[model samples]
Target: MSTATAASKTWIRTSASIRAYLQLMRPANIVTAWADILAGYSATGLVMSEQTWPPLLWLLLATTGLYAGGVVFNDVFDAELDAVERPERPIPSGQSSLKGAIGLGIALLGLGIGAAAQVSELSLGLAIVIAIAALLYDRFSKHHSLIGPINMGLCRGCNLLLGVSAVAEQTQMLWFLALIPLAYIGAITAISQGEVAGGQQRTGVIALLLLSMVTGALFGLSFLPSVQGWNLLPFTLLLIGLVFPPFLQAADTPNADMIRAAVKAGILALIVLDASLAAGFAGWPYGLVVLSLLPGSKGISRLFAMT
Candidate 1:
């Protein structure tokens, strides 16, 4: 073979390998994770101005690592199952190695904690908790129908808190808000259980109920002086429009494809949920910043799987 041709082949191989790792990270989901940090930071009533940008930047990087790590470990733990049920996945398909995935997961998780440590001890603590919760869900809790969703929810809840910890004092006052994402993610997790074999109608119903409660909580927050009630309405309605239809369809059909569709919509709609929260806490501009993430996430989702 000619030297030029060999180099071209090498480049192609490297690019393909990089794509595999990106796939493992679920780039679309990572984009949604950024919205969590943005919303959390916004909840503190802090401006994302030049002076405060450093901390916000740190928290965003922290979540990127945390989310990427969490999902990488998920694929690591599910390698055996994927080999049978999802053979197209990177590890199962030989695009990425299990040992490499483990190393990547650990490094990403460590990066998450370290980045948070740059912000404050409190942020570091929350990052560590998120990492632990993610690993627990991936390795053990995911096997249990009841505990699985809650465990997954815990990771997302703490993730939002990680953003709040940007201002140590604000976190103390706003800690309870984490429950919103917790409940929302819990519903998503519940619906995700049926991705392969199809979900139960009751499970879908329960998830829908949780979603409703989450919506109610977001709406109730609008009544607070810190939140702009009108600014929140558009994103809240967008969220409802994005998630409810798929979830309702899954609830009615309870089939594999519909369940997958519901799970995808829920995961992607996380940005919308966070945008609503940001708007409620900060203003429409900040909320729009959060909502802007949706397009990139959607574009990437077309290339890589969300669930």
Candidate 2:
């Protein structure tokens, strides 16, 4: 082959490899992590002030690394299962090697821990814990009945807390509130597993939805007394309203359609939650929320179109 052709072939291979890594990480799912980070940051009420960017950037990096590590580790543990259930995944599909995935996961975990250490000792500890939880969930909890969802929820809740601890002076109450998303994650994970395992179970899906709503409501109520006025109410209502339709729909349908709808609802709930926090601090939460939703909405729209 000519030199130019060889170079072109090399470039194609490199591009394909990059795409495989991205898919393995599941960038679409990372949206939930980003939202949690933002919500945590906003809840701190620091993002509104002048001294925001440093801790914000650090926490962002740490969270990204943590998420990347979790994604890779999950794939590492699920290689065999994916071969049976999702043979087209990066590992089973032959686009990426298990060894390479494991190496990348370990590197990302190290990077995340290092980044968290720069922020605070507490955050560094939380990062390590989150990484361990991810691994434990993938390896042990995933096959269990309800333990899987609980593990997934707790993992996400920790990610949110990591962001909060990175910038906030106190995070006890906020950390508790962060567990609200855990309920959401747990519900979604359980419902998803149900869909894959067999057909569907309305009772389980409904129970999960109720758990999510209750969690969200509890978080909202906890913040309400601290928030002075009606400013927070609108955002809370928006979030609750946004979450309700999808939760109901998912329970009613309980299939792939429900899964997609649930994803959209989760994305919207994150936007509302973040915007509420921003508003509680800055009084202009709607604009920031809209900005956050634009890119996500476009992506989801494209995904729906393709589907």
lDDT of each: 0.92, 0.69
What TM-score number comes out for model 1? Answer: 0.98
Model 1, backbone clash pairs (residues 3+ apart or across chains), number: 0
Top candidate when judged by TM-score against the true structure: 1
Per-residue CA lDDT of model 1 for 38-83, tens digit only, reads: 9898977667556468898899999999999999999999999999
lDDT of 2 by residue, 1-307 (tens): 9999999999998887777777767665566566666667766767658877888778778877888788888888889988997787788988888999988888888888888888888888888888898889878897776788789888888887887886546576666665666776676666556444432656446545655674455445534655533555566667777766766776777676665566556554655665565555445553265337536744854542211
Misplaced by over 4 Å in model 2 are: 167-169, 195-199, 202-208, 211-223, 240-242, 260-268, 286-294, 297-307
> lDDT of candidate 2?
0.69
Once model 2 is optimally superposed onto the true structure by TM-score, how far is the C-alpha of residue 255 displaced, in angstroms? 3.2
Candidate 2 at 104: error in angstroms?
A: 1.0
Q: Best candidate, lDDT-wise?
A: 1
